[model samples]
Each structure stands twice: as structure tokens, then as C-alpha cells.
Target: MKMDAFAFGITNWAEIDRTEHQGETGMAYWRTRYFGNYPNQIRVRWVEYTPGYRADHWCHKGHVLFCMEGELETTLDDGRKFVLTSGMSYQVGDNAEAHQSYSRSGAKLFIVD
Candidate 1:
């Protein structure tokens, strides 16, 4: 299906149940469209973290994180830490460090690659 600019639909994360990954924390809002009957190389997902939640240490092929709400802290394997709040965004991967995220008041992030 072809979509024009601004022709996509809005997907609400709260309406869907969170999928549990064995070692990951937070709920995820996910959506994707295939290209030419095959999976697309890029994916966009919104991840919501509850208070006192943290994710397992992992590395991505390439990713960008956009903080949509609340606060989140990420600690890298090298002990470097970054704190992000609403309206902030960062890119990682292709030499991206391994890291984990933690939130106290909860947070929502849009991740894309």
C-alpha cells in the first residue's frame, strides 16, 4: 500500500498489552510495514518504562532514541552515563556502546533504526 505524506495512522501504545522479553524491562509500542513483501530494514517502536524499571545490557545494530516524556538514565559498559529527559534524542550503534536504561519517574522513548 502506498501512503502519502501524513497519511499514516496514529497508534496508541496504551491500548495494546506489553510484550515481555526474557531479559528486558518496560512495555513496547511497535509498528512496522513490509517493503515489497519483505521485512523493512528499519523499525520504529515506542518503549515505555515504568518507575524503577531497567533494561538488560544489550547492543543494537544501529538505533536512535528520542525521549518523549519523563526522565531516563543510561549507563554504558565503560561506566559512561547519560541522562535524558523529555524532548531529547541521541544516536547509538556502529560502534555504539552496550548499555542499559533506568527510570525513576518513568519514561517513554521512540526508538528507530
Candidate 2:
């Protein structure tokens, strides 16, 4: 991804408003910040997944994601699956692989896309 022009900044995630996203089986809450303009923007987020959460759709967007607490399982459209636990991270390019996620016991993550 191209890094766009943006000034230095610090974020207090707790001060950001949380938005809810419904999953196939649960819910996800996110605190997000966007930098730069659309199409070249950088999105940074603090996210939480409710227990038994399973993404409702396949995502083709690129991301740099870090697991901060609990666990997350990611499944590719081709059936490949992987797991992430605290301190683990994954990176994927835009349109690289269509993927979805699940969390059986809830999780926290930091993501940039």
C-alpha cells in the first residue's frame, strides 16, 4: 500500500467512539481512525470480537493485523485456515486472498489497512 502524506499523531483508542458490526454468529466493536483521502487512505483500528463471532462475509481488502488478546481463526475461501493468538500478526495484500474470521472465545486486535 502507498503511504500517503499525513502528519505525526497519537491516538487514544478509548476516546474514539465504537461502532458495531454484526457477524454471522456474534458481533464486533471497533474504534477507528482514518488518515489521508479515500482510495489512498490508511485505516487504523482497535477491534473486539464477541465470543462465537464469525465474519459474515469474505473480505478482499489488504490488512496488517495483530492479535492482542484471546484468539482468532482465519479461513481463506480456498479452505485454508490459520490461527492467531496474543502477539501474533498477519499481513495480506489487497485482493490477495478472500478471507473471513471467527473467534470462539472473543478477541482483541489492532489492525491497519
Error at 109, model 1, angstroms: 0.7
* Pairs with steric clashes in candidate 1: 93-96
Off by over 4 Å in 1: 1-18, 22-40
Cα deviation of 31 in candidate 2 (Å)? 0.4
Per-residue lDDT of model 1, residues 33-105, tens digit only: 2222223344557777777777765564566889999998988779899999999988887556877778878
RMSD of each: 4.7, 0.7
Q: Going through the candidates in order, what is the number of backbone clashes in each?
A: 1, 0
Mark the 10 consecutive residues where model 2 has the least summed lDDT: 1-10
- All candidates: TM-score: 0.69, 0.97
What TM-score, to 2 decimals, does candidate 1 have? 0.69
Cα-lDDT of candidate 1 = 0.68
lDDT of 2 at 95: 99
| Whole-model lDDT per candidate | 0.68, 0.96
